[model samples]
Target: MTADDTVNQPSIALNSEVSAKCNEVVEEYRAGTASKVDAILRLQSIIPRSDDTEDQFKSALQSYVGMLDSADQARASAAKRGEQHDRSSSKRPRSPPESDDEDISEKPAKRSIDESRLPWVIDELLHPIELPPSLRLTRESLQLWSSNPKQYKASLTNAARCPEFPDSEWSNIIESKPINLDIVFAGHYSTSFDNRRTEKLGELELTFGETKPSKRIESAGDWLIAWTKASEALQFAFPHRERELREYGSYVTQLFGAVHPSRHHRVLQYEKAIRRRVSARRDLSLTDFSRFADLHLLHIDSSGAVALDEDSRPQARPNRGGDSRKRPGKGVEACRRWNEGRCPVDAARCRYTHICSTCRSREHTAEQCTNRARAN
Candidate 1:
């Protein structure tokens, strides 16, 4: 055959091969063997090399996919309306009606199904495209996917394909809470100070010296700076101290309130600093650092036992007896330990009253004191 004839013959053979694949797909659909989406994907995989034929195949596949999508929507709508349709109503059977018993299945089974399918679905959705090296699947991302599967599936799937994706991070994501680090750190530090002060007081008394006065925390900003500095110092002196602080911080934050933006930023900075320091000594993997940096602090109470102002600074605890209408004699006596600046007891568990710092008396704070001038 001539050169022109040879070229034309291969074009004809390619068209025939494409036609055969299309026919096979049609047969699969007619036999109810493959789903519409599956059939379309199959056709996509076998598109001819010719641009014209490829364009035609894509156009036809697009139209077919659209029809499949519409049918899915109709099926979902019917299900929501409680309409019982025959399984054989469509060329491809709809998934069996989920039995109520499905909900009653063991928690482990349900969790297993989720854990297995989530990564696979994510992989399929985000194939050939991956997430940035810095980002990983966080608890927030998992929650978002779990809450709105249809809405966030695309994004989650993309994130799942990230090279830095932590497959084992799912467990952590499931268990982690959006903890308020500042409040947690505050409680931890408060308790630590109390313990240390008691020890120091005992030492001073034995030496016939007076106990040192407590350092008053003027504002939330000041408190945060002090706590951050202390944490840095502790972590510097004892390498394991960082992990302990994180554990305590996570526990406190989860128990008390949501993470404040300022506190969250500071914690991230602290973690980054630690990572930098560690990397200097030994090569740090992005995976390890991501795991270390994964502070699951999202979706918590806006306000908790510890309150914060709009500026994300911790608000001073309200005075226990600020109301002018209350009788002074009926007021509870303040805890002497608390007044001396460190209450060893848990704030909530403590039986004694929390006194206002501005006034020594439990009757009122300086803000509400009628005898403010006299006291001054």
Candidate 2:
């Protein structure tokens, strides 16, 4: 492989020995017997034990996962607070009570940059990509980059790579977050070369990319930089950004693919894919997003449905089977008609899965999901 080729390592499938261990780790995770990092470390290891396995796992996951349990607990607490506010508000009757339209109006409007513009992928949660990233791979530039100690060392770190290449670094190089080497080598930079920064940033564009890039300072990298700000990769510092980036990346990943994820179906399929790439591995690319114009991740199924074969003929089963040991991101969404007791189709012939609508697990229905019980 060429020196620059190291930045794009292909996914290495598990060998028989590693596969056996993978099964154990995945099983432990499904049974809740293993912490996410613990299960991750088990699969990541080529050997059964290592002095630094856990440390390395944490360091890698820290790139985007944040403090796993702590973040979950914080979200759980916020959910509780929202519930309490709702309950107390319901108990307080207004003089004549608000009309339905007024009530709906009081509900927060969709987050947007303005009244006229379509909802952007960037906001407080997401910054905007200003320039297209380095393009051309010019011979002179390549020679200079190869010789520079800083760039040579950067190839080993995640911050120098795309997607997970930190937004923080655009503002401050010293604060670039640490990411796993596996993720560092993942982005298909060649794919995104065609995606240009159409929007103008004037003088500010230079701050995000090389001066005069794209003959106008703005380019694809700058645009991606904007999208990256709202990305899930930034969730550790901006907790509210998580859902927005997930929805955005998940959309891009499944955009042109068959068996698109069910956004309105309330299944965990897309969410889990986002979690696997961004949450589990700190990978920012969503499933070959750059294949068309965005991100891609290893083992991340943009199809958001079960593959019965290589052609990805989607199965009719309920649940994309999202939590399988063989693939990290696959799941069948619950059949909306069946969930509503309106589908006349048999379970064996339904278009969607018969799994739990909330968690997407086959173990229980949405009514029986733990979150529902807890809320009750």
Candidate 3:
């Protein structure tokens, strides 16, 4: 054989080997056998030095190095973000629930949530007992956002979802929003994976608690989780709409339902407050249609329930649901806003029949609760 043909064979064989290795990595990654980190290291190990690589091997070497660099960069970006998340989460202490008997500390409070001696929050975030396939959320949405920040911004803006906060406002926008659900679907960029992980630890950054402002976002995460979980509840609550979005009308309601998290958040919040314990969600009574699936604001007051839309009233109410509890009488009622520990400044004049928020007595506020004092 010619000397030239003999020389070319080895390079071709080596190039094929390199390509084969890369293909193996792709398969392992896709099959979930190898982690991104593992895959990166494997690719990096085979990359040759450009300076010493033979001319034939140079092209393959550059390709190898290029992949190695990209994987390293992606790995670093993801790791940095993971560290940030770890640092942020580690700051939260899982101390026992707060007690009235405990001494007040001059030191900074761990969080803003006033746990216990209150009405309720789900033991954990509540998802509907069953989930529909359409509502299955994944990181793909965030991936799209990450690949093109501008596209994410415009889509979120057009959908009326909050865009990622600017660096300046990131720390303090928790209170700028009315409720945690307002930012329930809030997305943030991960430098490690260059991902915009949505609703998946999304709360590490902020919260939408109607009850408290965030400091370390621990309480905010809880609040955000509570609100975020309501998405599935809404879907389960409204079958007609779910069916419409799937089978009938403009999918506008469905699109908005999935995208507009706060509206559902508010509806569920109201339902929880109104029902107190044992939410049967009877008769779509939980739905505040004005806000539910509505694409635009309509001179609405979020403070209390608004009138049902006439056009929607006939068609909107679900005919039946699980059994409901009796409405609380005015005199025996518990004020949820008061229990939240974030009652508006004008609460004294607030309309509602009332008993003590702490002890369920009519005599006085929780601090001065006559029943507790008597028991003590």
- Find the 10 residues in a row with the least total lDDT in model 1: 164-173
**Model 3 lDDT tens row, 204-285:** 6442322222111112233344333433333332333354323322222343345344344333333323322212222222
Reference-based TM-score, model 1: 0.24
What are the lDDT scores of the predictions, listed in order? 0.42, 0.38, 0.38
Instruction: TM-score for candidate 3, please give it.
Output: 0.19
Q: Give the C-alpha miss distance for residue 160 in model 1, angstroms.
A: 33
In candidate 1, position 282 carries an lDDT of 22
Per-residue lDDT tens digits for candidate 1, residues 1-376, read 3323423666547455555665567566656688987887776665533444455445555544554455566567878666444434545865764786865563353223333113223222222234433222332344455665544433432554332212122222223322222333444334223222223452363322222223333234434544454444334323434665556444433433344543443334333344344333222322343444333222122342222232364333445676523222335555566655455432333456545444655533344345666687
Q: So what's the TM-score on candidate 2?
A: 0.19
Estimate the TM-score of every prediction.
0.24, 0.19, 0.19
Runs of candidate 1 exceeding 4 Å displacement: 1-111, 114-176, 192-376
What's each prediction's clash count?
A: 2, 41, 6
Error of 1 at 59 (Å): 22
Candidates sorted by TM-score, best first: 1, 2, 3
Clashing pairs in 1: 178-297, 178-298
